[model samples]
Target chain A: MSTQTDTRSSAVVAGSFEGDPRRYLRGLGGLLVFLLVWWVGAMTTQPSYLVPGPLDSVRAFIDLFATTTAIVVPVSGSDLVLPTGLAHLTETLFHYVPGLLLGASCGVSLGLAMGWNGALDDWLRPLVRVLRPIPPLAWVVFAIVWFGIHHTGAAFIVFVGAFWINFYGAYGGVEGVSTDLTDAASTLGVERDLSMLKLVALPSAAPQVLTGFRTSIGRCWMIVVGAELFGAPGVGYEIINASNNLAMATSVAYMFLISLAFLCMDVGFRLLEGRVLAWR
Target chain B: MALSSESSVDRESREKITVRNVSRAYDSTQALEGVSLSVGEGEFCCIVGPSGCGKTTLLRAIAGLDDPDGGSILVGGDPVTGPGLDRGMVFQEYALFPWRTVRGNVRFGLDRPACDCADCEARVRELIDLVGLDGFEDAYPKELSGGMKQRVGIARALAPDPEILLMDEPFGSVDARTRDRLHAELLDIWAQTGQTVVFVTHDIDEAVTLADRVVVMDAEPGSVQSTFSIGIERPRERTSREFVDYVARIRDELGSPIDTIE
Candidate 1:
């Protein structure tokens, strides 16, 4: 019996080490290996311009922060100079934050309402089904027509992309709430329909709703970059401009910047989610 | 015992529950049929039966969580229309909200318009202490054991100070030792509060152990088979001949084939 217990304890110890930290270390190792192979490939290539090394990309990234661009102020007709990196990044965030906030809030509210209320679900489901299939980029022409070639137009496109993801998230969350929970609340004197929804249904659906929020955060970042590809001043536009000018290293640098920004946002959101769902 | 043969009119005046000709059906299955029983004020009544028996259905109907197809259920001389604050129920699964802390779950029912803030807080704290969960008030439901979770369930049910406490197989999930402890605690609470309790269970020993009167029920259109009064006093010895006799009688009435086979 003691020997069997020792074997079981050893197995448990082995199982614990097999998770999380080891997996993270393996991921980091794989990334380093990939970078090494890319660097080697770049050195072996025929021309340096075709495949700039990792060091060249890092230099280009630094240059973006140092470089300034001169633009004529539209309203004042004055020469205004700004760092290209800061200006483009600020422009992207201006649209991205407001658009994501607006779309996510509206979508979650509507989705929860529709999921909770049978009448609202019947009224809105068909319209949503018809509209959901049309891609957000398809609204670019309409956005440009309505808001013109400005921040609002780009924001509108990003909103369209984020809205659908949040809508589905909240809808599924509310639908997934077990009937047993609602009955429990009813016995606890939360019998009114509105109160039941508020007290029981909403909290029960929070994990799924938060999952929707997290997913939309990643999705909005992707959409914002795509939205900026069309005459909008963001990292995506910088990448296109650099590649067009045969500065492939600069293009790759901007791509890395976008990825870094996404990683920061994703990690931050995951931490917040962990704190909120600590009970689970 | 003398109260059992009293007319409906006289019994209704003093009894906490007067379930008369109550019947319920789910689609094609007759869950309950013409079930009638009366529980006196502050009486501890346990309904025992086999699987497929409509004990849970009857308890749910009494709690006003479900509606009966026919007949009337009266609590304190009023017809049970729907779920109200006057009836508190403890579920078998210990349905304490996962997100809410022990205090928060207990406070759920106390946040009504009828209860003042200070009084509600005091009552919640009192119940937390009464259920032997004073130190763990801030702990979430997931952090608790099966027995501890059911204690939270009891505390949450008692928070509103309801007159009628309905428990459906509340200790069925707990181990025997934990269940024994819970039974003692529950009886103490019941004696202190003077609340009418209608407990449903499949375990005959459990019914005999906890109930003042053991109500035996038959399945397949579930109806009351017979009623046995347990005159044995509090903290009743499980090994006592009287206790064993009560358990055996109830088991026999419940149609347990173990005794017959032996």
Candidate 2:
């Protein structure tokens, strides 16, 4: 096992970012290939009701963009969106931003707290076990009742999906910090609170936090759709509206946008992770 | 038992550290029971023993990294309760922060408000230069060799000019060649600074070569088996008869004097 790991590390070191092109271009190429396959398969399908071609979806998107003049949730029955494309995107962003910020922040804090304290970690483990099994969608009813069809309703869904992953990531990162670093700090006379955390704890846990943060971002995208399905306005709502009106092409168009958004976020996250973890 | 023995060593260089009957245990096992030792200011003392003999626990207590269930350690005549700035430590692993550069690691001890005086920067630079890391100040621990990282560790420990330096097998992790080079550097640093150093090692040669007095501790429930004062002069030859005799003496104490392991 050790030999295998050593071989893998040496291989990685030998070719690690050395004349490699696993950059944005690779991501774009994959995206284009996926879309091309999707496009071809859609064109070939005998019954296009379930799968509209990319061109057909775009046509419906343009028509929806040009025609929309007012907006609300698909369930709200306030049909026409004012200058539709941007408006719907902005509405989705509103829910996503709040959820992402609140959920990620709280999750990170909880993870740090739990990882640092053994008592808290042991106490919360069983609680997390119980809470984690409950799907984020189970909270939709409470989301609607408590938030009443607002962005908060959508945000709650996203938060549920994201919070636990980040919490656990942060916990693992903090717990894995090298005892040597702590010993070094103690010897150097750094016995204070903030200094200890900054010097020894946080930096040590960074890789774990980044992994958790990245994982949470993916979960947030999933939860946003669940949020939209329940009474919140988003790209999901646009799809729901187009479907009920029997405009399957527009529904496909909305879905395309959701996929595009998630793809863009994953790419952005990888870049940020690379930059932050770079030791210099 | 060992503590009182050290207090009365009485070859004064100002009595910086005084240990009093310090005992430590883990669950049912005693690592150190009724163990005590002291170091006068400017003394180079080495604690040598077999593995699991609580040489480390003794060093930890002096640094306040571990608390003795009984007795106390007085650093510059103040009782030690917990880890503090008065004592500096160098671990076997070097313990340099992986994320920080060599200079950054050294600056850790220098960050205290007390150390932030006008001389702090110069003091840090001098130690950095003293450790022979003149050009690699900006290099992080990951980029460094084992010996280099330990140099950073040593430099950081010395940056604050603490009254005592508590080293726990600090050179144990380095290669033999690097360890030899570092041993010379450490002795030179000790001669110049006169910092009270309490170094622990299992290697008898290291204990004899670097110490004014090598305190030998027995295994299991570690006790100070004997203290051998090296009367040999500076730049002592490891190949010489005197050096071999010192190693032989410690070797004899470990088993039957008649049939001891080399």
Candidate 3:
């Protein structure tokens, strides 16, 4: 430890924006190869609907946004016209955003509380163990029965998926906080319990907690699609509905839409994580 | 316990810290046994001993981070029930909060909300300058050298203006040259602040260089073996005959390692 020299703000030279072009070109080359293979598979298939070439999927994707659909607003009792692509995307976000936000918040809070308090941890441990193994999909039956085939029902499944990941992430983080740090805080006039937790343990555990949240961000997207498959109005429904009609290209296009949405969200989340967990 | 009120008042005025027959055992092992010591106001006292001598346990007991199974610790005539702001501690690992910058770590003991107020910022800036880390206020612990980190730790402990400073082998991890520099800086700070400091270390030379009075302890139910007062003046030469004599005498009292090995 003593041998290490100070190496901060010095490793990176100014105005050196040079990044390796070969790596970027290589990634582009890989994508082109994948597209070629997919095109060949589409050509050889007995029916074009069975396999979608990249070009066909792209065309279908464009048509989804170009076309308009009438959506009935339940609260306003009015018919709203929006692009087909946006209507379904909005439906997915309706559940996905709320479910993830609510579940992750509750999970993080409870996990921190339980991890910090020994008696709370003991009391909750058995219940968490029992509930953890039951898959999120297994709750679809209860979600439909309890909330009906509405956005709330689909949101519940997404919530369940997000909750567990964040709980374990926060719990493990708090559990791993070094006792030396807390002892240091205690001597510095910060009392034990909540203040120590907020000032010392929370910051210590932040990297892990944020990593879990990022993981859930991607996971909930996958769960969002699954939740909407059971007659809820969203991109997942469009994918299944198009497939039943043998419009495989449209199904693949909606699948692409989901992928693009997830990518955008993941990138945005990474930027936020970089700012918040800069100390790591 | 039987001391008269008049003598107790004098003791309180003269002594900054008093540990009375403090005993602590961990499960099957006795970590500290009937240890008693007093540190005078504004005194620099170092506890020197071999490994497992409960020097750290005794320091923790004094810091109120740990409680003795039997006996008590008093700071400013008040019984130490738990860790309080009157005493500040520095650890060997330089346990600065990794999430905070050098300025943040130093300002932590101030017990104020992190605000942009002039008074708080000036106090923090003064501490940073005092520790000779003027330009590196925004640097995190991971970006710092071991010496710099320990300096931050020292600054943080001093920020609260505590009456007593407790340190546990705070310079153990730094290189020798850095340790010597830190020794001088610590002495300078001690002179400036006049806070009674109790430092624990295994290095005999460190004890000799930094301590006004060195307390030697022995293992196997750790207890104080003896105490030596160095009459050497400020910035005493390590090579001087008097300084060398004190180190040798303290080493002799510690019992040479060959005796333990045999």
Highest lDDT, which number? 3
Q: How far is candidate 2 from the true structure (C-alpha RMSD, Å)?
A: 6.4
lDDT of 1 by residue, A194-262 (tens): 888788778888898888888888888888878778877688888888989989999998888888888
* TM-score (chain B) of candidate 3: 0.92
* Poorly placed runs, candidate 1 (over 4 Å): A1-24, A68-82, B1-13, B256-262
Fnat, model by model in order, equals 0.38, 0.41, 0.48
Q: Write the per-residue lDDT of candidate 3 for residues B93-201, one digit (tens) a residue.
A: 9889999999999989886333456777888898888878888889888777788889999999988888999999999898888888888889888777777899999
B-chain TM-score for every candidate: 0.92, 0.90, 0.92
What lDDT would candidate 3 get against the real structure? 0.86
Report the lDDT tens digits of candidate 3 across residue range A1-280.
1222332323424334347777778889999999999999999998788898889999999999999987765446578788999888887887889899988998888889888889999999999999999888789999999999778898899999999999988999999999889888988888748789899989999988888899999999888888888888889999999999998999999999999999998999899988887665
Candidate order by decreasing TM-score? 3, 1, 2
Model 2 lDDT tens row, B155-241: 888888787888999988777877888888888787666678999988888888898889988766877888888888878899999
DockQ, ranked from best to worst: 3, 2, 1
User: Model 1, range B1-262, lDDT digits (tens) per residue?
Assistant: 0224443234324789999999999998888999999998878899988776799999999999899999999988899999888899999998888889989998998886457887788888888888877777787887777888888899888888898999999998988877888898898788777778999988878888888888988888889999998988878999999999988877777776532332
In the order shown, what is each candidate's alpha-carbon RMSD? 5.8, 6.4, 4.8
List the pairs of residues colliding in candidate 3. none
| Interface DockQ of candidate 1 | 0.32
